[model samples]
Target: MKVNYDAQNDVLKISLSSTPVRNCDFDKPGVVLGYGSDGSLVDLEIREASRKIDNPRSVDLAMNGRSVHGVRLL
Candidate 1:
């Protein structure tokens, strides 16, 4: 999985190579979006990220519909 953001286009893209993506759909007026392959979400994206999400934790919270504080890498 890889994530990229294009500030010029105001587009945030999340892609899953192993899972594959057949289409992209906006979940809530472009703020949150779903990346689907065969009707299952392979990835997710957050648009206008700077406005809605203060940090990475907010992103997880929004996507999962919960209050996920953070992600740890080791």
Candidate 2:
């Protein structure tokens, strides 16, 4: 997994390399938006810190202002 942020273009690119992505619908890629105290980006956030372990049912994620743990299989 890899994450890159381009401050100049205000673009964020997220990718997964070690594992193949499944059940994902990608449309040429885009941006995500979030509001904050300073301001907000009305674009996209390619949150890269998300992954599945053991099986595709469970995932670990980190994004925005929080960290997630032990996501169960669904």
* Candidate maximizing TM-score: 1
In candidate 1, what are the lDDT values of residues 1-74, reduced to their tens digit?
A: 66666555555666655575677666577555455556876767766755655543223433556665455311
Off by over 4 Å in 1: 18-20, 32-37, 55-74
lDDT of 1: 0.57
The estimated TM-scores of all candidates read 0.46, 0.28
lDDT of each: 0.57, 0.43
How well is each residue in 1-74 modelled by candidate 2, as lDDT tens digits?
A: 55454444544444434333333334544434433333432233543323311333344678896889666532
**Model 1, residue pairs in steric clash:** none
